[model samples]
Target chain A: MKFGIGMFGDSGYDTKTNRFRDPEKRLKEIVEEVIQADTLGIDLFAMGEHHREDYVVSSPETMLAALSTVTKNIILSSGVNVISSADPVKLFQDYAMIDLLSGQRAEIMAGRGSFIESFPLFGQNLNDYNELFAEKLNLLLRLNKEEKINWKGTFRAPLKDQTIFPRPKREIPVWIAVGGTPTSVLRAAQLGLPIMFAIIGGNPRQFLPLVDYYKEQYALAGHAKDKMEIGVHAHTYIGDSRQAVLKAYYPAYSFQMNRIGKERGWSGSFTQSQFEAGMSMQGALYMGSAEEVTEKLINTIELFGLTRYIAHI
Target chain B: MKFGIGMFGDSGYDTKTNRFRDPEKRLKEIVEEVIQADTLGIDLFAMGEHHREDYVVSSPETMLAALSTVTKNIILSSGVNVISSADPVKLFQDYAMIDLLSGQRAEIMAGRGSFIESFPLFGQNLNDYNELFAEKLNLLLRLNKEEKINWKGTFRAPLKDQTIFPRPKREIPVWIAVGGTPTSVLRAAQLGLPIMFAIIGGNPRQFLPLVDYYKEQYALAGHAKDKMEIGVHAHTYIGDSRQAVLKAYYPAYSFQMNRIGKERGWSGSFTQSQFEAGMSMQGALYMGSAEEVTEKLINTIELFGLTRYIAHI
Candidate 1:
């Protein structure tokens, strides 16, 4: 199976002093980490876009473009490019540039961003969020399908037989990143695009119907099965001992979950006990010793027929 | 004065049949050219933007981003980023990305663009061209000036107290590129921004008044004279000898000029006589042996007090 890792540049907090790594240092460290990942036979190293006070990267393509040089074989991708709040023409041009610089090792992961701050920041209304994404994705696909485009949409300016320059030498990979929305899954499947399921939480097995449904729809739609690959994205950690991994990751994971929960108004705290339960065999968390985590991954892949797996560390 | 060159792919013609270089080869050649410039003690190597079949680069940041990784000390710049047809927020992020990768060596040359093709391509009206540029320039300046912006404008979506991330460690230089527009020069001077003038045709002495007016206005506007830099961008070629450079560059320049002139409906055949005359001491073009061109540049600098000279070779 193809393996990848997401470099989120997740702010590290000292369980001892409650301090976070400096943003600049965190960004530079991330560059080093991705360069290291390239030497480890990793197939892909994607950077996710998050516009927040806690996160460092707001533009994933920028980070990926920076990593294009030091990297040898690892495919550089935007874990998600938040297409809902972006100008797709410009976005396409940036990725095309990355493709040229990286010797065609560029990929785009389009998603309706988890954080809604970009909607207002880019002067997009939340009511038209999905519509914006659908329209932009359509335009982006048209750009990919051909050099010149004649497209009209409600959100963005219409293109009239316009061609984006610095076009890629090859058709770069375009994956649809979704978070358990059946409509999103069906859309990707109907369009014959690869689906990247973000199983960050909840019972991972509960999403079986969605992946199976996607495959059936993809096949029914008559896309080549050999060319299709479904991927799963999970938060994972591997330590020498299960207990050590649990102890080290629990506090940091709890801090992050609490922060996200607070932002989303979840009304409940994610305690260490909940974390322990999530680390169980059927749990969404992949926190454990290498052997245990690897066993769980094998089972999950067999269960879902996943061809690609991305673990965010 | 600082010396820089525009790494224009120049689309080499088949000297025998007058066929242009393929776009891919043109782009690859540009990368090598810029790398050569860096090792040759050049202070800056910039790439200009063009949206046409004959031109390879439409997004300068894309090219600059790629060059940032290979070069050591040479500054990477968009010789002109057609800001009039671009979104300032996206433009800021791309250039900021370049700056971070290049170790604070990113510069942006903002221009209204010599070619009008982008206006319709980007869904902008020709009638509102200058107004669109003015509005976008204001937004770009505001983004450059502050981290958190509460900006409103007619051309673009309004931002309500939002921050543009990955702000450059040091302020990246932004120069106003103009083609003999007195009003544009006055605007740049009023804003205390450097002016990059295009002296492509006619007698170069004709612009002495404009440059003098800019300096007077710049001083009157309370900007330090020492901090002020006015640049001249001219067509230049330095070869083994005057005859060799002329014979080599004339055919290609003629092909390009005829192509552009045809597009703009300017019926003018630039014959060898006119080309030779244009290379005279008082003429705008800077072509000949290195010694002759260097002497001309020295004399021109003494005459206009130019702080930067960019040759589009």
Candidate 2:
């Protein structure tokens, strides 16, 4: 089983000041963190994409490209590149170069994005959200599989016998990142692509039906069972003991939760009771001592038949 | 004065085999070459973009992003980003992140491109060439100066109160690269933007008039005189001895010149006599022994009042 770490390059919250950290400092910290992850023998480092002040990275591929030179033995990937609002041609070219630069350790995870800011930013229409993802993913897959492409699509201009340069030494892995959407999972399974479910909140057991659906659909689609890859991403923190970890992590964690929650119109502030429930074995938040966290990870891995697990810190 | 090295990640040509070298190897060499440049105290490294098999880098920013981690003290830039066919918003965001990553060492040199391949690949029409560059450059300048933008253009999507994230530590320098186009030179001067003249062939003295024109227009536009930055990019090779350098560089140089000449439908192949003329003190090619190259560079820098010189290899 592969274990990985993921981050959105979150700008640190200085609880005393109640202000966001400088993005440049946060970006440098991210680079150091990933280098440390590589030193610690982490299998993967997935960088998240966010085009907001709270996050330092707008282009995960760009950040990954920076890390490609400094890190070794870590598979660099986008936790989720909002591909629906991106040009797949450009995306393919960027990641292909990253693959070559990193000696073949680059992967792309496509998603519709958990936020809608990119839609207007890139001139993409919100009404065409599903269609945009479907069409762009189609184009991206073709760009990967074919040396020359002749494709037409509604969202972007058509490619006429075009080929992107700086081709990767090997086929870069492309994963589908979904936020517990059955239709999204079904699409990934049907396409025989690896699926990464982002389980940020609620009960971990609730996703069991979606995981089973993906496996059933994947098998029905005649993909090799041994080659099937399923992964989970969840908010996680680990320390020598649960109390010490909670003491350090909760202020910043709760601040971010409430900040994003306020934007999303969540009715109640995150409470210690809810946080304790989330830390429980049945909940999605993976936080505790090393042994406790490991046990929880193993349980989730076995329950979902996952090939990979990513701690979204 | 700033002196820099620029490359298109040109895949080496094997004369005996009459074949191109591997791009993966060339890319690694590029990283090494830039690191060495930084170590040697080169002020800048400008990567070129090409959407062809002969050139490995199609996204100079991607290559620059990769180099940001490995090299320190070298300004990372696109020799010419072919910005006419690019999205200025994305370009600004990428360079902003690159600037933050490299401690304010990121720059963008915008050009209409010497080749037409990117236009077709990016779904842009040749007919809209001038308009595209004009519109994109305008938007790019606004993105650099403003916290939020409300922009509309004929070529790309309009921006409405949009602000790109991960803002640079300082305003990223944007230079205009012109290939002896009087109109292009005028636009750069009027905008008070730095100008990089690409002098690939013919007599260097011939550009004196264009350089003077830029200075006159720039001063007329009420820009600060000392702030005016003018640069020249030319093919350059430096060696210990003139004969040894000729023997080593001539075969490959003539081969590339003829190859590109053929593609452009030039009348005759590149001859050694022409190469000899190009190597003269009056010529544009900055090749010869160290003393000879220094003399030629001094002459050019003095003649054009250049602030920066980029040796394009």
Best by lDDT: 2
RMSD in angstroms, candidate 2?
1.0
Q: List the candidate 1 regions with Cα displacement exceeding 4 Å.
A: A11-23, B10-22
Candidate 2: regions farther than 4 A off = none
Model 2 Cα lDDT, one tens digit per residue, B27-72: 9899999999999999999999999878899899999999998888
Across residues B36-58, which tens digit of lDDT does each residue of candidate 1 receive? Answer: 88999899887888776566677
**Ten residues in sequence with the least summed lDDT for candidate 1 chain B:** B7-16
| Model 1 complex DockQ against the native | 0.47
Docking class of 1: acceptable
Clashing pairs in 1: none
Cα deviation in Å at residue A285, candidate 1? 2.4
Candidate 2 lDDT score at position A94: 95
Q: What is the C-alpha RMSD of each candidate to the true structure, in Å?
A: 2.2, 1.0
